[model samples]
Target: MRAIKKVKKFIERSPNSTEGITFAKLILALESENEFPVIELYQLNSDEFDLAIELLKDWRIDCFYVGKAKAFDSATRAKNLS
Candidate 1:
């Protein structure tokens, strides 16, 4: 959950940033049966970009299931709503 918390904090610190929005969407994709474009990450600064890659790596290796499960549940709910 640390990585997810860090990413949430990063988004909170710069809610209006393109990187924030992009990361938010990327997280959503990670949580669901969806895919995000790798090219979009090129828009981020090094730190943000690294975090995005870290998220992917963590998710790929199934390192954070509980948090990802919660995120996926939330995404499923929102998708069902709209």
Candidate 2:
């Protein structure tokens, strides 16, 4: 709980830290409990956020609303993966 709070504070102080911290914390959490936690860490753009979300979706981690539509749509269309 303390670590999670620290991560949240770090994110608030440095919004750009999402991807790295998120991935690292997620791996740690999964390793510890064999299951992901349910929480939304905002600030990642949709495409970048989606990559992480998809990786953990089956584990029940939920990463909600993170990017502008234009950017997300463009990325989705360009990659043809959405």
Candidate 3:
């Protein structure tokens, strides 16, 4: 469970990344359910955030899958936290 939280935090804030403010907005969108164009409740590896944009790819709970753009966009700075 701890590892999962870490993933979320990294997605929430990649402090070591160089993506800038766009990264932050992506974080907000990931955490937010209805605030952004996407809604991702599962955690993903930092590197995979940009390329893994599949429906029901890594979900912990089963629900309607509506895959959108990967990581909200390439502009989102996502750094590996592990």
The most accurate candidate by TM-score is: 1
Candidate 2 global CA lDDT score: 0.56
Clashing residue pairs for model 1 = none
| Candidate 2 steric clashes | 0
Query: Model 3 over residues 1-82: C-alpha lDDT tens digits?
Result: 3333444565567655543333445545554643643333224445545433321233312222333344444335454432
Reference-based lDDT, residue 42, model 3: 26
* Model 3 TM-score, all chains together: 0.24
Q: Please tell me which model should have the higher TM-score, number 2 or number 3.
A: 2
Question: What does candidate 1's lDDT look like per residue over 19-68, in tens digits?
Answer: 88998898888878598988899988888888888877876767467778
lDDT of 2 at 39: 56
Decoy 2 TM-score against native? 0.37
Question: RMSD per prediction, one decimal?
Answer: 9.1, 13.5, 17.6
Model 1, residue 49: distance off in Å is 0.9
Alpha-carbon runs more than 4 Å astray in model 2: 1-17, 34-40, 58-82
In model 3, the runs with Cα more than 4 Å from the true position are 1-6, 9-13, 19-24, 35-46, 50-82
Error of 3 at 71 (Å): 30
